[model samples]
Target: MTDSARPRRATLSDVAAAAGVSQATVSKALNGRDDVAAETREIVLAAVAELGYRPTTAPAASSRRTIAVTFDIPASPYILNVLQGVLVAATENRLDLLTRLPPDRAARGQRAVGRDWIAEQRASGAIGVVGLTLSHPDALLDAASEASLPFVMVDPVDATHKRLVSVASSNWAGARTAADYLIGLGHRRIAWIGGPEASDAARDRLYGYRAALDAAGLEIDPAHVVADQFDAAAGARHARAMLGMDLPPTAIMAADDEIAVGVLAAARELGVSVPRDLSVIGFDDTPQAPWTTPPLTTVHQHLDEMGRMAVHTVVAIADGRRPVSRHVELATSLTIRETTAPPPA
Candidate 1:
């Protein structure tokens, strides 16, 4: 055939472009690298087939699978504990676990950026994704859906997408239990310090606390309710202010263990002895909860189980099975420690 009439042969670059992945990823996928996610491999293979691209070397066979997990910075005990469960489940399932940070906030809201982010995940061989306390995930979730990638969120923050699948602790019930316990302890002036206003878990916990007070026929004290960051600093700041009030609360309920730690610090600074002058209760019985001064009495949420469930849910979705529910809430129990007692007379 004349050179002008001959069809152009497809190159590796063409396949990579078609697959929306890097050339390195294409090679890894073709070579059956264990690090490549199964879904990513399938994408590359499809591109190769569509473009009729052929490598000089024959492709290798492999059965490795991977999932991607994304989280924010300054990882807390709750996050670390949940990660432990994710790692264990990934190992048990014989899958590779990839950890990542989300894209920059400035660009993540753009549709194209979100799509590219999902493509990168697919390129890395991730068939599914798990997000831990990921905030503003609507764009990413939309892109994942368009690409048919399975995604699960654990304790998501500020996520409003209706199709989101997630796993979390029973926040409302847990908080209510904590409040009731304080009431049972003869602590009538109860105060609440909560997590961020945008957190659904935080809102649920606050509602639970209110519900408990209502059930006990106690009036809600707006002055005693404070919503702020989930860190110890926010907790300490709020606690100090509340403790300094002319009619101070006899007990305080914190949204998480970190915040509860700050509450302890503030009480100490003010010379208020725990369970003597005041009682404190916190949510999320993370590993650090038991190590707090006087060992914090907090609500026990199975964080690891939530992580394990997230992996299982994503894997099941990838297998073309729908989850039993879009949202799953694990049970919570109260872990009584040295920080709670009857209110000082």
Candidate 2:
């Protein structure tokens, strides 16, 4: 064959060009530099694969298998705690953990995009995947299954598929316990500020709150129940609105510690002293829970354990072993602190 007719070999420049990044960025991504963003790295790798470009000096391949963990924006203390467990478990099991941000929601519904996303994981040497509180993961789940990759969700939100494997705390029981405790403290008018309705865990907690109120023979007040995002801002917004009412609740149950923090802020702004005029309780006893103005009283969900369990379960599935159960729920308990007391007269 004539030399002129021969195909040109792809180079690092080709990959950089394909990925719309600089050559230095491509190099940084290839070398596993921490300074490189995860999304940029993924893009570079995809470009390299598409162009069939081989690195001139490949790093020594480690024996450790990799698992990818995907999470959304605004990482919370709860997520960080779970990640700590996941990291510990991964280290103990001699596996590499890769953190990823999920693909754009707008393109998630397309079959080609979903398949490409899974293909990228495979190309990156990921044996399994763990999603932390991911929303609308149906397409990704389907793609992962088609690729024969093990997938586990840690406290998944808005998941419609029933055949998924997941690890979470006993949300309903935990919420019920918190509500029952408030009722026992002479709080007849209780309000709930919870996470989004799309979340299964959020729904379960809401149901638990309702159940506790029913058991106490209290009327279910629609105005007292609210479902919103699991953040301090949402908590603060809802708390302010409720506190301004003619008949504000004596106690409020927050979906998570962050929300509880916001509730505290709102109460302070409204000149309502906690446990004097109102009581408050929150879920996900995150580390920050104890640092509030008056330390928060919250339901403790074993966040680290949930993360560890997810890693173990996904690894087990990757090794061709069936989990004893598709869904696992860890126990939750109330951590009493200064934030809760009997309602004022």
Candidate 3:
């Protein structure tokens, strides 16, 4: 191999390093492995193209069978439950899964950079996508569409998004059910701990709780409705303020289990007894609910079911089939537990 006859060529290692994936993953992306995610595959292919990398052996296949799952964060039981279900479904379907997060934004309301990503997915032969929270979903949808890939949204912010497929629990009905359950237990004054006021799901739940009160001919005390970020700390913060009121609510209905857990902690700190002095209800029967000091009464939002459904939808699209519905909503059921009881006399 003389210097005149030899030229430097990019190898799999170079592509892998550039794409921030392993060599094996790059190989899987190019060779049509059923285990490579679409986004990762796209990244590999783009690197391959950019670096002018050529395979020493057989070239990549024409078709790629992979599903990509994206999320805002991998923490929290609600997200974990959904992810576990997706993993199970992927195994059952014999499909590869890839998970990624949106590029970090300097601030809110600014879209994440994604035009090149969609192009890469197309070139890399990605078949489908399950989006949890893409900072710039509109761009992704367009890119995915252009690449002939199907995109499914789990717990979308807006169910009425015309161009997207979304799967979620019935938030409105679930909130209403929780409130009604508290009322059934002879609790007249109930407080609601809600997520961000800007969230549609949170708004729906707040309204549902209010609707339940309205139907029962009970006035919803505006002061009782405190906003939280659907976390334990936020729940605690809001609960303290409410619990310190001139006349506190006999029961509290939380928008989510995390918030409810925080509320429970607040109750404990303030020496409020569960079910005896105060009844509590939460939404999203996450794993935390069962382990609380007194098991929390909550609305079961079917996180696992939603995850399974999301996988099924994306897979169907990959197989050249269309989903029966663009918007799929699973039913919510009330789980009666130790935290709720008839109001104290």
* Candidate 3 structure quality by residue, lDDT tens digits, 235-316: 8898889889998999999988999999899999999999899998999899889999899999998898888899999889
Cα lDDT tens digits for candidate 2, 1-345: 899999787888998999999998887776666899989888887776566565444333655688899888547998999999999999998887888888898887776676677767765667789999988888888878766678899998987776899999999999999999999999999999989999999999999999999999998778889999999999999999999999999999999998999999999998999979989999999999899989999999999999999999998988889998999999999999999999997
Best by TM-score: 1
Residue 313 lDDT (model 1): 93
**Which regions in candidate 1 have their CA more than 4 angstroms from the true location?**
1-61
The pairs that clash in candidate 2 are none
C-alpha RMSD of each candidate structure in angstroms: 7.3, 8.2, 9.2
What local lDDT score does residue 3 receive in model 1, on the 0 to 100 scale?
94
> How accurate locally is residue 341 in candidate 3, as Cα lDDT from 0 to 100?
92
TM-score of 3: 0.80
Candidate 2 residue runs with Cα over 4 Å from true position: 1-60
Clashes of each: 1, 0, 0
> Using alpha carbons, what is the TM-score of model 2?
0.83
List model 1 lDDT by residue over 1-345, tens digit each: 999899887888999999999998998986657788888887886776456554533333437788899988537988999998999889888888999888888887787677767766765667789999988888999888876778899998888888999999899999999999999989889999999899999999999999999999998778999999999999999999999999999999999999999999999999999989999999989988889889999999998999999999998987779899999999999999999999998
